[model samples]
Target: MSTSLVVGGSGRTGRRVVERLLAAGRPVAVLSRRPRPAAGVRTIVGDLDDPATWPAALADVDGVVVCVGPPHDAAGAETVVHRGVAALAAAAAERDLRVVLVSQIYVTRPQAHPAMAHVTEARARGEQALRASGADPAVVRPGWLTDEPATGVRLEQGDTGWPTALAALTPDAVAGSL
Candidate 1:
């Protein structure tokens, strides 16, 4: 069976991704700064800022799903989002592993809200880095995430915004898409 690593597996969305993968019967590992023990899942403690910790979690893994997000501090967003995701993409590329990056919709838009500009910029950079890594990765850009129940989902390409009626997407819906 194929084994995959879920980066940021302790976060809200990441947790859902882990559960979805496990339910699908895929062997999974979680990369986190703290230990997260789940039956049939392996947890590898590591920091995204420290490159040395990557290989151990990635070893023998067939793919990776990056669910990490930028820190609240704008200054740290670059390191955590851009640099961190870039590093992960590079390492995954080296191993010929498939990569799925969970990104935000319209992150590169010039009209993004001022309060979220920094994070959007960092996410945009992360997307660029992943594309440049020669990994042919799949990017999932979810609309504002919510805890609402999963009604259904749709996939579209290009710069399309979520309908005004659909205010947010549930983490469960996004995880299932991955």
Candidate 2:
């Protein structure tokens, strides 16, 4: 991909993705409701919740990487995660661009944990939207994020296990997986 719009590039996970993309000598841009990237990276400050806010054909943009979600504001759960991502996915699909969406482990089992209820329900919808939108998204499912040093890496598919990794898997490692 020539240029990929990174959602939540200012946040921990997306920041790591942006840094790695830049280090690889790739052109990087971010789509955010607000905030900007470091110098040299293009920043598109817009809220995805607004359908009209989606930018079109800027700099031959070819892909997207979404790393935005909870530890988020529960109030904006539906708008930000589901509706917004769905719209963005549709836009990307229309352009034939691939999308890499960073989702969480609890999405499949929505009511399993009360603490993540909001995120669970919303992310489920977001995943469904990406699928239905035909963005050909690669969804990364992680668990409760901790800033502790990444001790190991593991991948399991059943969506039933420890909520997180063996040791607190750092954002850096998670980004590496991407």
Candidate 3:
């Protein structure tokens, strides 16, 4: 069976990725700082600051999905997503594994919202690093997420929502897209 490593597995998108991967009969491993239990998914405790734990979590994995978001501070955001994503890409390159990275839509249009500058910059940097790492990356740029449940969701390419679009997406909707 194929194996997948999901970073930020407990977060909005990460958790759903874990669930979907498991449902597809793939071996799932979740990498997070505060690891939690999820049926059918193996949880691995770790963080981006020390990627040493990544090798173990990524062992024999066919693909890696980075769904981790930036931190509150600008520098921290860069470190966690940009630098951390670069590290994951490097690791996947060494093992010849595919990668799927989650990025926000606003990052490309910084002028759309003044408050989103730093985050958008950080996400753009992360995407750049992944593209440079020789890993065939599937970049998912989602719109404003809605917690309004997943009864009906429409996933499309490109930026569909804005900073205040308020069109939140449930984790299941994103999982379905994947």
Candidate 4:
């Protein structure tokens, strides 16, 4: 990759991905609402839900990684996750850039928790939009991610009760994932 745009790149998972991408000699640009102290990466202050921000964010980008966190409110979640991701998918398809979406495991069981159901549903919808957009994006739904060191990876299908605890997304792990 030449230049990769990491949405929500100041977050724990995104930070690690940015680091790994930078270390690999690929320039990285981060589109985030909050400003972070990152030296090499270009940090663009913007919201993923806003369409206007994407023009500048994707201007010099080759690949994209959507690590966006949904808002607590139902409407905000829908706008950010569903609408934001759909916009991202459309942009990626137009530019022929592959996307790597970082989603959570709870998205599978959106109804499992009534309180946070909206967030899960929104992310699930985003995943659906990406799939339907024909962007051929890679979606990684990790369970209980942590900032610690990584163990390994195991593929499973619609897993329900596995990984009750946190799994780490260290730089090495993030490099492997990217």
Write down the TM-score for model 2.
0.82
Q: Quote each prediction's TM-score.
A: 0.87, 0.82, 0.83, 0.86
> What lDDT is obtained when candidate 3 is compared to the true structure?
0.81
Order of the predicted models by lDDT, top scorer first: 4, 1, 3, 2
Displacement of residue 137 (Cα, Å) in model 4 is: 0.8
lDDT of 1 by residue, 69-93 (tens): 6796677888888898899889888
Counting clashing residue pairs in each candidate, in order, gives 0, 0, 4, 0
**Candidate 3 residue-wise lDDT, 1-178, digit = tens:** 7679898999987877887888888899888998788777788889865779877988878899989877867898889878888888888888888899988887678677777688788888998899999987889887655545665545666665653334555575556755
What are the Cα lDDT values of the candidates?
Answer: 0.83, 0.77, 0.81, 0.84
Cα RMSD to the true fold for all candidates: 4.8, 5.0, 5.2, 5.3
Q: Tell me the deviation in Å of residue 93 in model 3.
A: 0.9
lDDT of 4 by residue, 26-138 (tens): 99999999959688888899988888887888888989998977889999999999989999888888888888999877787777778999999999999999988878699
Q: Write the per-residue lDDT of candidate 2 for residues 49-163, one digit (tens) a residue.
A: 7667565423477778888855455768888888888998888888888888888886777787887788778888988899989777788887657766675567776576464
Which 10 consecutive positions of candidate 4 have the poorest summed lDDT? 159-168
lDDT of 1 at 76: 87
| Residue 46 in candidate 2, Cα distance off native in Å | 0.9
